[model samples]
Target: MKVTTTLIAAALACGASFAEAQAVQYAGGKTTFDGKCVVCHQAGGKGMDGLAPPLVEYPGKYAGTDEGRRHLGHTVLYGMFGPIKVKDKSYNFKMPSFASMSDAEIAEVLNYVVFDLNAQHGSAKPFDAEQIKALRASPVDGSAVHAQRESVVKSLGL
Candidate 1:
């Protein structure tokens, strides 16, 4: 009985730690988004007219599948410029590179975006730093935004 009780206590403690860590991460993400992405994506991820694409319901545009996630991460780390389509709407704007940010912070911001959008639109799978790192390592120049989008679409069989 004592052993079982000890095990339960340990589990509870670990769970609490995990929850605390997640809370911290979420807070960091919120801060990063406000500092960086909010200029265009807006505080609510709704974006600005004729300036940036809305991040709400963006999972439908960039997270419904594996290919979408890859594309979105690449776009985020390297930035995107020129013309692209989101939710069948064309957006010709510049997204500045956030390469200055640490991979963990990038991940946190992405998690916040994904979680917020998913909650709004009912999607699954939030992106993380590892995925962002891989995309960043690849050869994606923001200048060639359309090419990257085409590649992602091809990969998605879209």
Candidate 2:
């Protein structure tokens, strides 16, 4: 009976720690978004005209499938520049890289974005930490030549 009690206590402690960690991660993400993305994406993520694209709906260009999620994660970490099309409109804007952000923080911010935006846009799936990490590890050129915004939009049927 004593051994069983000890095991139960350990399990509870572990669960509590896990929950705490999750809470911290979420809070960190919220903070990061507020500091960075909120300015352009806006508090509601509606985005600023001529400056940022609305994140209300998953850009037909980047959401839903794994490939879409990977593209978005890479874009967020490395940034995108030059002319890009979203919702059938083209904008020549610069998106700076957040490469200095820690993996955990990037994951957290991404999770927050995916979950919150998906809810707003009625998406069934959301990007998670693991997905973000995998995308971050993949090779992406954060260069002007690699922007390929028009082609990507065309491929996505945007």
Candidate 3:
């Protein structure tokens, strides 16, 4: 009876730890977004008109593809500037680099954006910290990042 009770208690503790981890993932993501991105993207990632483009669509779609996933890592690590079209709208703005953030933070925030905010990501796996870490070896300014974005968008047909 004592052995059975101990096993049950261990199982319960593991379940609680799993739940807490899940909660922390989203909560950290939300905190990161709110503190860093919400000012430009606004609540729910709606974005500002003629300012920052809405993140609700393309980012989720980007998460779905391999190159697109890399693009997300590049954009965040390097930042982006210049004019880009999203849907039927155009945005010519400079997005500052978030290179200061840790790899895990980048992954978590992107997972929040791609999974929680945008519903179109489909079966895309959550952004992993290694991906962000790999991109960190080469650093580029926001303008170069924007130029690369043009290529990425064209290739992806976004």
lDDT of each: 0.73, 0.66, 0.85
Residue-wise lDDT of candidate 2 within 92-133, one digit each (tens)?
657788878877778777766666544542442545667667
* Ranking of all predicted structures according to TM-score, beginning with the best and ending with the worst: 3, 1, 2
Candidate 3: clashing pairs of residues? none
Winning model by lDDT: 3
Clash number for every model?
0, 0, 0
TM-score of 3: 0.80
Residues 1-158, candidate 1, lDDT per residue (tens digit)? 99999999999999997986575436778889889889888876887777798877654445767767766676777788887666567778889888878888887887777775445434546667777777777757787655767777676554
Candidate 3, residues 26-132, lDDT tens digits: the string is 66888899999999999778999999989898888888778788778888888888888998999987888899999999999999888878868876898878888
Off by over 4 Å in 1: 1-25, 120-123, 150-158
**Which 10-residue window in model 1 sums to the lowest lDDT?**
116-125
Better of 1 and 3 by TM-score: 3
Model 2 poorest ten-residue lDDT run:
144-153
What lDDT is reached at residue 2 by model 3?
100
